[model samples]
Target: MVLKTAIFFVISIAAFAVMFTTMAPLTGFLSYHDVPRIVKDNNEETNWFALTESLLWDIFLVLLFIVQHSMMATPTWRGLIYNLGLVVVERSFYIAATAWALQYIMQSWLVIPDYPLWIIDTSQSTPWWWFFTLIHVMAWIIIYGATFTMDLPELLGLKQCLYRDTAWEFALICTICLTARFTNKGIQ
Candidate 1:
């Protein structure tokens, strides 16, 4: 029991690390991952077939992540984990799985042909760059702040595995960690 908890605690922490690492650019670290080409000025040379395939591939990646994320949260899934006597590490496993899904998407998501729907031209000398950077920094600060409002360690399975909690605490911990995820619990 101790070993399982210890291992999962490490796994969950690693998962969170990967999540932060990849999410920064995709959700927060834009255009950093390895792609031969990024958003070009225009995509007049795009091939229809190749573009279609890439778009479909991106859609599939997103859908697969959604399915895995949604499936794990269902009561039936929880019951299976409980029956398997894996409740102690369920949250950790879920976090790990979530990380895996995000990692896959982040690594595989195709950069579609650039349409440049709307171009915001803030030259290097302009303060708009700093303004936008400041806004992005502020946004991330608020996100992290909101995350701390909830028991992040417990949600990540650190406290749960480290300390013995009563049934009520366990049940609450089983719910997906809030912050933008929770309709009623987030900044709603």
Candidate 2:
């Protein structure tokens, strides 16, 4: 029992690390490594057999992400893992796979040609840029705060071997806050 718990703990930590690392690029904060921001023309010169090659690679990455995400979340897949005696790390495996897929997508993303519907120059409109950035940051904060209000261990499947009841009242409050935040964003 102790060994199993230890193994699961390690897997969970690793999955979390991967998820965290992928978030910056996924959120358009950092492009790949030290690249500060991703621009539309970032992949203009990097072509293979043709420009279609890059587009095809991007499409392939998206398909890979969809497949891994949808397949692993199914009941049949969980049952297969349970039958294989690896149910303890099922969620960790799913999280790790998702993180890997996201990372690959971010790394291989082909920036499409510049065809902006609207452009906001942050240098000229600093105040407006900061305002929008603040709103975006607040939206993410609300979402993450709501996630923490629930039984996160259970959500992550860690509570299966160690049970903990969720605080329904807190969850309800968080849900309300999340809904309000989404509505406000939609209005804006």
Q: Tell me, by TM-score, which candidate is best.
A: 1
- Candidate 2 lDDT, tens digit per residue, 1-188? 67866776777767767776776667663312222244557656654465677668878988888999999989999999979877767776887788888887777777544433345556556787677777777777787789899987756656543421245346658879888888946743
Question: Over 4 Å off in model 1, which ranges?
Answer: 1-46, 123-125, 165-188
The C-alpha TM-scores of every prediction are: 0.70, 0.66
lDDT of 1 by residue, 1-188 (tens): 56766675676677567656765656543522222334554645767787788889988988999999999999999999989976766787788788778778777877663543355544543677667667767777887789889998877766656564446365566654453376766564
For candidate 2, what is the lDDT?
Answer: 0.68
In candidate 1, position 174 carries an lDDT of: 60
**Alpha carbon lDDT of residue 133, candidate 1?**
67
Q: Tell me model 1's lDDT, rounded to 2 decimals.
A: 0.69
How well does candidate 2 score on lDDT at residue 45? Answer: 69
Report the number of the highest-lDDT candidate: 1
